[model samples]
Target chain A: MIEEVFAVGTSRIHRVDPRHRVVFAAVFSVQTAIGKEPAALILALAAALVLVLAARLDARRVLQRSVPVLAFLMLLWLVLPWTVPGRPWLTTGPLSASMEGVRLSWQISLKSISILLALMALTATMTAATLGHALHHLGVPEKIVSLLMITYRYLFVIEAEFTRLWRAAKVRGFRPRTNLHSYRTYAYLVGMLFVRASDRAERVYAAMRCRGFKGKFYTLAVFPAGRDTVWFSLGMSGLAIAMAAAEWTATV
Target chain B: MDRTDPIIELKGVSFAYPGGPQVIRHLDFALHKRDRIGLVAPNGSGKTTLLHLILGLLKPSEGEVRLFGRSMRGEKDFVLLRTKIGLLFQDADDQLFNPTVIEDVAFGPLNTGKTREEALAISRDTLHRLGLSGFEDRITHKLSGGEKQMVAMATIVALQPEALLLDEPTVGLDEKTHKRLIALLAELALPCVIISHAFDFLSATTDRILTMENGRIVLDEEMRVHIHEHAHKLGSKPHRHV
Candidate 1:
């Protein structure tokens, strides 16, 4: 159920150092989230598109991933213009659509899509294991990094366990319907999953101790920054600076 | 330590979980050098609890665990001893927590203060020994059941431990893979305590068998090959004996 589709690639984005990609993603996301100017937001969106293209990601899959965020933005579009009090752009019956609310909604949608695309192209290009190590190298807390790594490792196992339970229920003629019986069955299934997960957790802890784990996770992975990493860092920095300049000039 | 001294010893070990019934009661056991012991029991018979107590994963309610002829009382004592005694958990998924096979195998050696390169070398050598050389970069969860079990074994073997404690090592294995595992266990020279329900597997891999019932050993005997003819009904034959 938990698959790293973007992590498998041969593009230049994949070859770039995961640490550099992570940093760039963070910087770009923060900048796009706070910036309100149309010019800067559009430029950021364009840059994100370029990143998506450079990463060689499938356009169809990218669009599929964006569907949820787009649906959320559509909800905002439905409510914002009619609710906010400002200069009326359109009027019908008792509702008046405002220009200010439309602009605000437009800015938000752009920012959200831009940030999502940027993250998908950059951070998602590396495996979760690489991301965990990169976060550790970038000074994230050891405990948090270990948590991420371990969670990533076991998500599939837990999902498989859940699947097995669900299958067993299905095989036993347990059908779901809008009734208390189905609800109770679902509740029991979830409860059983928690019980099994906790049991597995205890066994996992004991196994960790058996291997002489001393509360510190030592990684054998080494992320070597190559020429591509240097170039990627410089390019991202230049784009961010240009976006900041655009935002500043537009504000003035 | 003398050569004849028990490598692992339990004296009057008794334990009960908080607000739970006693899992183990006054259990005394010893593992000597060159001892290949199999422990068999029904579920909830304290076989696994016994192994955990010896590893210091659980503190006995009333008794002591000794390893290498030294009494172990605290977590600090088990920290150093764990590196010397490898353990294979009942579930391979619980034992392997790393993304890739090599990382999981190298975890023990890395914890023991081996350098990255040294740990990787040890992991490679261990995997090679277990006939899993090409699985270094493979995602651990993607492997088959038998493969995961072998990789779990490789993780422990990488530690170069003095002894091994295996819990249900043959739980989900097929006949061919089961034979392979038995052969692999035979190749290892270190003493081991294996927990399993399969009498045939135990007989093949262990020198002695200990049966447990209600948190106590009820039968301890030398494992011997016992072959007998069984009847089969086929075709027009009333009863065919082989």
Candidate 2:
């Protein structure tokens, strides 16, 4: 019941090693951070776009996910320039958006979008588990890896339970009008869920023991790129050339 | 039955929650190396508790649990004995905390100190055997229920345990998957104990039937006798293993 609600669509990106895309995404994120040139930023943005297209991700869906991140960045963009006034780009006689401040905010937004896009492409084609394994293979500790594993494994279960509770709310006339009193509304449900989860944890622990679990957590290692380290390195540097160009432009 | 040489021997095993009433009371059973047993009970009857006793995760409130004829008197014995037991819990999510099918399948062997290649080989062999070759890279949480169970079983298979303990092995499965599971269990050469409520499945896959009532083994018999004496079974308040 935890696997899926449907069939995963077929695509080339889907067939690639999960680590390949995640590493590329992460590398791109680092490049965006270090590079200040418009060329590097633009190239980073281009790389992210290519991934989205290659993954066959729909723009609308991507935008829907990007909206919150985008909105958060925009909020920062609006607030930072206005509050941190410097030598006036626009001001209320005292606290004004400086020229450099405005430019910095724009740069921040652009950089964020680039980073978010890279992550989006990575997550779009690769499921959460694959990404976790990739990170684990790249030398992430088992404790953290297992936490991510458990989170990915149980996320749907929790979501399903949430959906059920949501439906229950709907059935019991739980429409929250703009002026409705609903702060402590689902708190009881949350408490009940905690109790249920604890009980489940106890049962799960019992089950684990029954199957011979000790304190030691074990797992298989499938780091495909590690075996092909030289090849991956060459490819990364090839892309870094464009990143270098972008960084050079940002400073100007 | 040579009680002295039992693979898993339990004697007068009793357990009471720390702050609650006595849960498991005066239990006794001994499993042979290749014996296939089933544990059936209702929702709170200490079936899980009993299993934990054998696993050494929980010490009995009274009496003792023995593994390979050695009493698990301390934490070390429990640790040493756990390697021999392969447990597949009812929830695949908990048992399989690996990202992909292959990695999850390889986890047990890897922890036991198997190299990457060795782990990969065992993972591949088990997945192929379980009919999950195409799913090596697939997200574990995205697999179908039946497929998840298959992968979960593969984890045990890769672990190479002497005995397998499966809790509700095929619950939440479709009828087709259920039949397939019973056949798979029956074909597995290793000794396995299945804790399930599915009477037909238990009868089909296991050589022995066991029921826990009030934290004790109220019924332990061959499958044939179990069905034959179904009507005269005592106080139908089904045992709760959980």
Candidate 3:
């Protein structure tokens, strides 16, 4: 559940200031993404997994949430090995699994899981509100921060609206089929959802204006840098640099 | 029945959507200080539109909207005027757009140039007033319908508006929440122009009832408690109830 994903708890990782978490996660994610050597990627993955454990996050839940991403990686693994033309690792009739392609797929899969785990551990422990405040304090534009805030807040609402429309369709004997009528109906439903959402946006703006909103968003929460904040950033940055060193050594 | 100078007034008001039929036609109304006015109208009536016009959210084709003794003509004027009159939307989801409840409630105070601590204090007090203490960090979208409604109201009252313009404030509330809302609203000492379809709620909350039909005020009278007597179809005896 979304609520469960964002539930606040007292853990060391959770106590790490949101600004530090955001910056470290972003920098580490970029490092992991650019990494090519399996040794360094493995180290990165291990570091992320250890963070998850230290955070006391539910590993099973994180895996469950990662199912869709893992599934997409599986698709890449299936297609890449047979499609890329290189020194074949295995051959079956006309299909050849290339060693280079397999290695590339492994790299992508490891990077994705490492970054995903890092994000869940470092960032998802805090509420989105905290993240927005962190982003604002990190010098992100107020407009962008507010946009993110509103989008995060209204996502569930729009999803509920979609579900309501879907249920209404279901009760009216609407059935999905491989037919033009079904496709048209689905298109119309999406169009209607957009229309309703736009109308809601207008009303929301009016509501904001009614409360003296003059094209600016203000949040009361402030994430001031404390001792823990500095220590957390230094620790995370050191780990990131170590990973980068590992990548360079492995390539050399 | 206490009345004073008009807090809200509309003169020769007529409104029409672009390339559409007129929604409001030649409507004139005034809400005085200490007046609790309930506007009851059927769906498709111009009740919400009328409220928007008063707030300067919508412009009437040919009319003047005077709020707190000043004619609202432009964006700058409306911007200043809006701080004095809070408008509660029909859907709480539309109103509570901040990531957290407290931030949403504090948005107005912050925009009005209050310090962060001051805004937080105001938000906490307002939420406490609405019986929502400790909901400061509650995710706005994840709240229950009733909680969202209360939080939305808290957002408005945090600004300390002199008047309220409510559009179906109790639309999707459960009975318990509805009663709580009525209680909270009853405690407010500000003028209000409430648009609602719930006749019973209107009867209980407002001092005057105005019924709108076809873009015009069809009825305006002092609200009085009236008992409805109805018999079950299978029973012969009439049951009296208020």
Q: By lDDT, who's the top model here? A: 1
lDDT of 1 by residue, A1-252 (tens): 766899999998998999889999999999999998898999999999999999999999899989999999999999999998899999998899999999999999999999999999998888888999899988999999988988888888889999999999999999999999999999999999999889888888889888988889888778877888888888999999999999899888
Model 2 / residue A79 / CA error / Å: 4.4
**Tens-place lDDT digits, model 2, residues A71-94:** 898788868888665678775765
What fraction of the correct interface contacts does each predicted structure contain? Answer: 0.93, 0.47, 0.98
**Interface RMSD values for the candidates, listed in order?**
0.9, 3.2, 1.0
Model 1 Cα lDDT, one tens digit per residue, B1-242: 77778999999889998899999988888999989998877788888888889899989989889999989989999998987998898889999989899999999999999999999999999888788879998988889999999999999999999999999998777677788788888888789999987777877888888877667675655544365556555646542121
Report the C-alpha lDDT of model 2 over B79-173, residue by residue, as the tens digit.
66686778777777666655677777777776677888888898898777766678888777678878888888888888778788788887667
> Could you give candidate 3's per-residue lDDT for residues B1-242 as a string of tens digits?
12455888899899998998899999998888878988876787889889898888998899888887888787778888887888898889889888878889989999999999999899899998888999998778879888888888899899899899888888667777778788888898688988877777877788887888778876655545465755567556432121
Chain A alone, TM-score per model: 0.97, 0.77, 0.89
Error of 3 at B178 (Å): 3.7
Per-candidate TM equals: 0.93, 0.78, 0.90
Clashing residue pairs, backbone N/CA/C < 3 A, model 1: none
Give candidate 3's whole-model lDDT.
Answer: 0.85
On the 0 to 100 scale, the lDDT of residue A164 in model 1 is 96
DockQ of each: 0.80, 0.35, 0.80
The model with the greatest TM-score is 1
